[model samples]
Target: MGQVREGTTWLSVIWRVCNVFMSLFFALATYVQINDPDAGMWMVGYGVPSVLCALISWKPLVSEHLAWRRVADLHVMISSSVVIMLGWRIHKEQITQIFQQEEGREFFGLLLTSMWLLLCRHSGRSAVGKLRVFTAVAITLFPFITWFYYHVNKELRSEWPSHCKTAI
Candidate 1:
């Protein structure tokens, strides 16, 4: 039998952790929704990407070349920055709130796309310029797309805190 490569083993551990985090986020969202209707919707909104990430992680074929760690790092950085900015905008927002914003969700989605592009690039599996363009577009438009979706969806209004009324 072929042994698992060392890199693959480490990658598996990292992916597992990411999956666990996503799962926990999903559970928390469900719990919040059960306990408080208003907050529950916000949790549900955030949980969508978390669930997506978890599902993606489950597929070794999907996670292997995608460099999930690098994508996750970028997501954490970008999302954290947006969260901090939002917190600053609304004095009442807590540091932890940055982790729970829609911006964070979008970051993960964009990160996934970018990582896929990188995979294609490394594998020489597609036209070179295409992946670059896709990565650039995904990174550039992620925040706007997320904000647009959040604002246009009237149902998500309840997810916003009264004090943090302004868009981040």
Candidate 2:
């Protein structure tokens, strides 16, 4: 019983660490959007999650609050809608290399945000599951890895719009 409890505590710590990383990632995402043509929309989109994740990191049970849940739900709804629209556009246009296009990248960004919110939705009410911890680690690593890839392969971004190129 003591061993099981210790494991659970470790999982909780890992989960919070994941949230901390994600909060930083979202903040950086928000920062880079400042150069976007529609900076306000994207800034708010990324900014909300950054704040939400930071709250979770600081207080894991913050998600249980009515206001927090409401804000998260609303953001997820808006992001999901945009994701659907972007998916349709991508399908209709038959975009081959999604990472090569701005809309495609936006699609993935919103999808990531929505998925993370959903993962965190009921977290305050239960022990951090092992599966959730594993998933969080994977999700947390994805954006960083992809960003590094783009940073290293500068040629891939040669055709990016002027605004996209300006991001750090």
Q: How many residue pairs clash in each candidate?
A: 1, 0
For each candidate in turn, the TM-score is 0.36, 0.98
Local lDDT at 97 for model 1: 48
lDDT (0 to 1) per candidate: 0.46, 0.95
Candidate 2 wrong stretches, greater than 4 Å: none
Model 2 agreement with the true structure over 1-168: per-residue lDDT tens digits: 999999999999999999999999999999999889899999999999999999999999999999999999999999999999999999999998898999899999999999999999979898998999999999999999999999999999988898998877
True-vs-predicted CA distance for residue 62, candidate 1, Å:
4.3
The RMSD of every model to the true structure, in order and in angstroms, is 13.5, 0.7
Candidate 2: Cα lDDT at 155? 98
- lDDT per residue, candidate 1, 24-63, as tens digits? 5444434544433355445544454455456554653443
lDDT score, residue 17, model 1?
48
